[model samples]
Target: MSRKTFIKGTLILTLAGVLTKIFGFGCRIFLSRSIGAAGMGLYQLIMPVTAVCYAIGIAGPEVCVSRFCAAYAASRDHLRARHTAVFCFGMSMILCIICTVLSYMGADIIAGYIFHNPHVAPLIRISVFSVPFACIHCLVCAYYISKERTVIPAVSQIFEQAVRLGAIYIIVHIAHNKGEEITAAVGVAGLVCGEIAAALLCAAIVLTGRRKNIRTTRHPGIEVKQIIKTSIPVSLNRLALHGMQSLEAALIPLMLTVYGYSAQHSVAIFGILTGMAMPVILFPSTLTGSVAQMLLPSVAKEQSSSDKLIKSSRMALVFSLAFGFICIIGYTTAGAVIMAYVFDEPKLSGYIRIMAWLCPFIFINTTYKSMLHALGQAGRVLLNSMLSELITIICIVFLIPRMGIYAYLLGLLASQAANSALSICAFTRTVSRITTHKPLRS
Candidate 1:
């Protein structure tokens, strides 16, 4: 693609992502008001399981499809690109079904035993239905992304958020009027509905577009084995990363309880930090995240070209750092005021400040991880992720017990920093190796 087209695509996607995140954050604000801290806590506790399921079932395969499709298209192998998409979609469907079953069956154990909140089980089950929807939505979005078509996915995201927020308002209102306090569960149900709607919308868009570009070939070969080979390492990396994150979520309450806080307090604290503070602090990074998603295909297409790869990587890094810095400054200056006024929780300002410190690292890590996926260095990514998680677990195990909730946050910040460093190092080495063999001539 030309530079102009790429810039235009990036801008469109970035704007869409920013708008979607804004809506999502606004939804959270309304949810917090409707459900209160304790209810939000229940909502947050059930999320780690859902997040892990999503990571394992959808995220990895989606990226693999995006990367392979982009590379195949660049090589003028349209049939291969379509075949890869079909294979990835199939694998993602199988994974999603398995994960959904496990999620439904394990909801009670996760709620009662892990989080010590049995009331969250129903909410967990409701969220399970979203897995298949999310898997399909992500794969379709990846196909669009690989085709250098950003508008469809961007529009789909906006539509999805509209459905989600609208459903949440209606469901929560109905529940409130009934004199029942199930706002959190209602919120999750809205999420499931929205994801299913989005999946259907995107599927229609993709199928319609595919029909217009149909090639009457004797055989559009499906390379199922190659797709799985590329997907497995990426899948395992996502699994480990999400597994560690989930472990942190499940352990926080237990860790706090061991350090002399009640289950309610632990849940409330965890909810505010994860659902509220982290989202608020990282809101500004949505642009970078969106850009990184677009950048992956561009990078993969230009992987053998050192100058182009370096230029794209450096541009993405610069953008991520600049955005992260702005967020840090804004959040650091206005965090307390926003927390107090918006959330009505002045005490959460401290956690907000701590989490804000992690903004740059998180943003950088996200961009680098995307670039690595584009480079097909999934094994390296997995190793880096595992090492970072090990460091986090050790810190959490030792520090949370002795120093308390603050220690857990500190561990999180440290882990992100470590992961960012590792990603940067690996990315640098990969770029260097490519440049050395195939130098870009002036």
Candidate 2:
């Protein structure tokens, strides 16, 4: 893995990510228009549960597979990589089942208590079906990524988005022609269908293209205890981060309702903030995400050489900062126009501007977290994420009641900033320790 190869891999993955983001955002716009603001609100409202479940089922194991498989491949242990993939897939399936059951049973409580909308329970349950499919797709994609084969995942992403968008269009049109309430539920159905398609497509790609020479190790002499120990922290970190994010989704809307906003207004604001504004603000982050995913394994495989790790980490950080700044400026200048043109709502311009401030912090935080995960510092990531979320939640609790939607955005910005600062400090220290010794000879 020379720097040239690394750059080449990064470029392919980045291009893929950009394509995925474009398709995804396009889907968002179409869905928002199809469902209207209230429908979009209902659709967006249940997603926190979706995000948390998917993260719990997939995130840590996928990351672990990516990092470990890359290292194993680098060491010429293809058999180990295969075994690890098997173990990961198996584990993900089990988690998916558990999540499915829990989500179904707890949907009522989540809707009534968490979101303050008993009507949202059915939507949450329906959306939960996507969890296993998403988890499996992520796990398979991780293996391909570990092999530095970006094309498959890239193609799968496009396919997934196409399927999702197409389904949403047809379903929403039919449902809207009937009534708004049905349209909202139909939108959730579209999500479930899209996830199913994505999972099947990814599975087909992996099965069809996986090399025959890569043999699975029979009873690989690895300790399950060690694997679990290594994986738990990463899992818990993802769980905390995503859990908090989900909680925020539920809380923000509830707070808005308490502040005298109508249900429709609360939903509309949430949709605009999460679906419209956040996407625009975070568009520049796709580059860092692609690079970080690639860099994680690259860093782990080169862990013996601190210089290499630090060099890669610094390069990624610099790129993220530069990209984030560009996004901030671009969104600041053109965000309103884009919102007006896309959503036919110029009133959203303020929210868009405020949300754009989150770009730099979010990008930096993501890059830093990736670096820590690469270095097997999942506990640190967890602690930092929990602290940031706690701070943000406390702020939101105090501010949202008094200040309204703006307070929610402020809390988000503050949390991301805190996370970014902590990640930078931790990543700096780790890189310093790694680079203190001379680079190992290739």
Candidate 2 lDDT over 1-442, as tens digits, reads: 6788778777887787888788777777887776677777778888878888877778778887888888888988777788888888888889988999999999999988888888789999899999999987888888988988877777777777778778877876776678755456767887788789989998877777665454444656544565676678888887888888877877887788788898779888887877777777767777778777777877778877777777776777787778778777887788667875787666668888778878888888877888788787888899999999987787667888889888887778888888998988887777676667632210
Q: Which residue pairs come into collision in candidate 1?
A: none
Candidate 1 lDDT over residue span 330-395, tens digit each: 777886568757877766787877778888888898888888888877878898889888877777
Please give the distance, in angstroms, between residue 55's alpha carbon in candidate 2 and its true position after superposition.
2.7
**How many clashing pairs per prediction, in order?**
0, 1
Q: What CA RMSD would candidate 2 show?
A: 3.0
Give lDDT: candidate 1, residue 86: 84
- The per-residue C-alpha lDDT of model 1 at residue 298 equals 83
- Give residue 304's error in model 2 in angstroms: 1.3
TM-score of model 1 (CA atoms): 0.94
Query: In model 2, what lDDT does residue 258 have?
Result: 80
